[model samples]
Target: MDIKAYIESGIIESYVLGLATPQEADELQRLSQTYPEIAAAVAGGEQWLRETADHYALPAPEELKTQLLARLEHEFQPEKQAPDLRYYRRDLFKYAAAVLLLLLTVSGLLNVYLYNNYRNASRDFVRLQSGIDMMAADNKAFQAKLAVLEQDLRFITAPGTIKVPLAGVSGREDYFATLYWNTQTKNVYLTANHLPAPAPGKQYQLWAIVDGKPVSAGLLNPNCTDLCMVTPVQQAQAFAITLEKTGGNPTPTSDQMVVLGKVKA
Candidate 1:
């Protein structure tokens, strides 16, 4: 396999971001074990992400350590009986080391996942914050928008949500996106996760093939959040996105199709 091409496909980003499905994750893990280049890429990505997050890390409160130690002391206290000093000391050190190691491992893993989520949320917040600050925004309006996003997240993470990876077409190998389709609800949501900003007066449009005809799913807004709701279809055999004139076209211009993916059976 082409290691460089695999790395450039954005699967690594999706995996690091916790967006890849179980199958995809399993495949990546297998590849990482089989290929030195993949293993290096994954490790490098994790290290770079950790270093980037360190700049934004906040210092813990002074009292926090004291409280943690106090709790640990209480938990490891001897029962209502005389204790062996040397044995107690040895066990105490062992347990303490184990606890510390566990905490560090969990914290590192949590930080990676949380950092990706925080980055996405921060982008959305920054985009709207300026307008909110200028308008002295209505709390209800803000909450409503937030509620919608929370709902979308629930749908995306819900069990049975099918993740379809869309790859860039000819001449646009770097462009990619994902489709989260809920079979039960027949709801389709599109995320322009890695696609570059379209040129002026051009926009990306999504299409779903149903009954041998192409149906416009929706026109993607470049400025929209990572997840955007597209028109729901009862059924689709495939999905494709194309760059079209602003406001989109009645039908996709074949020559302009940027990415496409077939729906799994």
Candidate 2:
């Protein structure tokens, strides 16, 4: 149990002021017996209430005191009618003052308790809202990735999209890749199928042969696992991929060529 929080919750004040519900009063009584801090708090509250009552007790007026004495003297001399209430008026006023002070103190403590509860609730709401926002952002990113995959699937399966298989060369026979060319739209896409991962500070670059000379077909992303977009080519007799430095070079290195395939006539 949070002893400090419980002590500051105003339960003890309510219990002392006779305003706590039966269940709350019972719980406080049980806790007070089990916890020394709670017992001390309850005892302190009772002592403070006693002191406040004594502080608010007003001295009876001299004239009222004399009058009460005179009335008491006549009570034994003749037939005393009904008992006069003026005799107990002073005690009644003291009791009322004590009760009023206790009530005001209880109200202040109750306000403090309510404010604490409000602050805690606001903090919980903020944490919950933050979690919801993070989840929404993650879900949005997943949706965007799914949309890209769907678009790639459609592009590969569409009509007029030619699939070209580029086989390994220069003793690297195990290396292979595929190229997709949309002849009608002139769009090109490539997949590094069965190709080994590039080394540090190195990437792959694509080339298209045009009129017996090589033309830049853009660089391949090192992390790409699916269809990666490549620069379009108007006319190409063959397509080739070569290992190059990061960001690639303007010209393909003939000795570093990994895969090549001639376009079908």
- Evaluated at residue 160, the lDDT of candidate 2 is 81
lDDT of 1 by residue, 31-90 (tens): 999999999888877776688679789999999999999889857756654457777998
TM-score for each candidate, following the candidate numbering: 0.44, 0.56
Candidate 2: which pairs clash? Answer: none
Model 1: residue 53 alpha-carbon error in angstroms: 99
Worst 10 residues of 2 by lDDT: 78-87
What's model 1's overall lDDT? 0.87
Candidate 1's displacement at residue 118, Å, is: 41
What is the C-alpha lDDT profile of model 2 across 7-82, one tens digit per residue? 9998888899999999999999899899999999999999988998899999888799788888898566545534
Number of clashes in every candidate structure? 0, 0
Q: Which stretches of candidate 1 lie over 4 Å from their true place?
A: 1-149
Candidate 2 error regions (>4 Å): 1-90, 170-176, 193-202, 210-213, 221-226, 245-251, 262-265
